[model samples]
Target: MRLLVAFTCLLAGCLAQKPQPCASPALMTGAFTVTTQNEKLEMYCKYEYDALGQRMRVKQQGTYQTKPFTRDYLLLFREGAMYQIFDTNRTCIKSALKDKFHPMEIPKDATLQGQVVLGSPSAPGQGLLVNTWTGDMPDKKGKYLSTVTEFGCIPINNSYQSDEYGWVVVNLYDNVNGIVDPGQLNPPDFCRDTVMKTDEEPKNFLSLFHNLP
Candidate 1:
């Protein structure tokens, strides 16, 4: 009888329903480190996101080609403009924004790998419950794995790999629920004299890093 009961409990656990899909907060501020194998590049960036308004801003500092550089990007999807500011040269370039706003949430089509505790589960209030999800990228050109907190849907880290870009990983931390400053969404003052690059085709945020000199 005891053996039968144990087997039944195990089966029930295995058949438990998966968690529902959850979206991240509409507004947020966070810092993330990005590394790419193809470019051999690493960057630390602070970002502000406004999902509801379809806007985002990122300030990144990193070394590329053995040269230290600081760049800021303001992507305004609603306005259909993207501003790229090079702090090292005090120059700004504007281009048409082509990427759609992507919220910081696990894709609904992603397969759940499993759930695990990030810290010691035995200690109360010390462990974080997180879920891992994997899926094909939207373009179907790559595969991605993402880890996020189960309770609040906060992103922890994400990794993507493809034949084109090799592997790119982003580790997110110091995230807060709402925008720290609305002003961060605006283009920097240095961009006042920016000129639109009419001949250059628009590229997404990640593509910009891959093309960095």
Candidate 2:
């Protein structure tokens, strides 16, 4: 009986410990560069790889050119050989020249949408209240705040009262820049009357990888 048990355990261990084959696809070639009237940028890029090439690194240097204005972002990538973050360090490269700039909105976590807009310094703490699509308009709803605080809440949270979503946007202050873009980060706002944002859970960095194939 003891021999049979040991044999079963050994088989399970062998099944669980099969070594994974290494992968070393070549680094991607070329940048998908584009320029618009508002902006034109180019990345001079290079590749660095692990012995397996499974781990990858991309070193990119580029200039953000808006006619007379120019700023350079030193970009690097640390993971995901197939589809990677343009800037692994998570720095705001041309934010200073961006249409919107907020030094206070940057966070310890990765910034998304116009730099994770800052909450009013006066706002007691972080919170959220659902209203119209904007979340800032006026209406009657049991308001609640969140402990999970974040950057500024905008017209969606600023100009309007909580729980007001209708044909008219009550709070014109909130510039509802909806939908977060990974490469771009923005400021966030709060307009919930009774609801405060809670630090319920942290945003996931790996979630960005979902966009990758």
Candidate 3:
């Protein structure tokens, strides 16, 4: 099924944070999988590294993910995970995880892995689907990068797409730092492990964090 979507690309500077490398610079290659509580969906990630053991880039693929339609690709990062998400349109998501488990952004000076962790209790703004990763590289212009650090969870700010995936009051939003050119995301990341669930069931992955049941 094809759905018509309205696009509102973020104006270049709308990015509230700096742009860091897509993946980490220490390790060379890695992979991880995140399964839903019910295990009906899975998010797969394959990381790539450069000669210096720096993660040069990464590609992602998944299904039953944000949508049960197609697959997409995302860039790996060092400060956190970076992915161009698609929902009617495309947008970027740059978020980082902290040593302490929080879901909000708080820039600090403590270096857990030789990098500052600017995390939060959750994502920057009101996001319906949020995920933080640091197995990528680091960049100075990136938003998820900072000297001060903290831990935060990705907030799944799904948009008002008529609840196509079984939502009524879906309010979609991108991480303040997530700014990408429309139609620029060659292949967006639709990994279920990184996606935010929006169901009323207590077994939903999103429910575990939203306190929903």
Compared with the true structure, all predictions reach lDDT values of 0.82, 0.25, 0.30
Model 1 TM-score, all chains together: 0.85
lDDT by residue (tens digit), candidate 3, 1-213: 111111112212223344332321222334434343343344454433332311223334444434433333333323333343555554444333222212222223322223322232133342222223222112232123222111233222211111122222222122233223323322345443454233422121122112211
Q: Tens digit of lDDT per residue, candidate 1, span 153-211?
A: 99999999856558988999999999999998987788867877779788676665676
2 versus 3: better lDDT goes to: 3
Model 3 ranges with Cα > 4 A deviation = 1-25, 49-56, 65-213
Best by TM-score: 1
For model 1, state the Cα shift of residue 162 in Å.
Answer: 3.9
- Winning model by lDDT: 1
Among residues 3 or more apart in sequence or in different chains, the pairs in candidate 1 whose N, CA or C atoms overlap within 3 Å are none
lDDT of 1: 0.82
In model 1, which range of ten residues has the least summed lDDT? 8-17
**Model 2 spans with C-alpha error above 4 angstroms:** 1-39, 50-53, 66-213
Order the candidate numbers by TM-score, best to worst.
1, 3, 2
- In model 1, the Cα lDDT at residue 107 comes to 74
Q: Give the TM-score of candidate 3.
A: 0.23
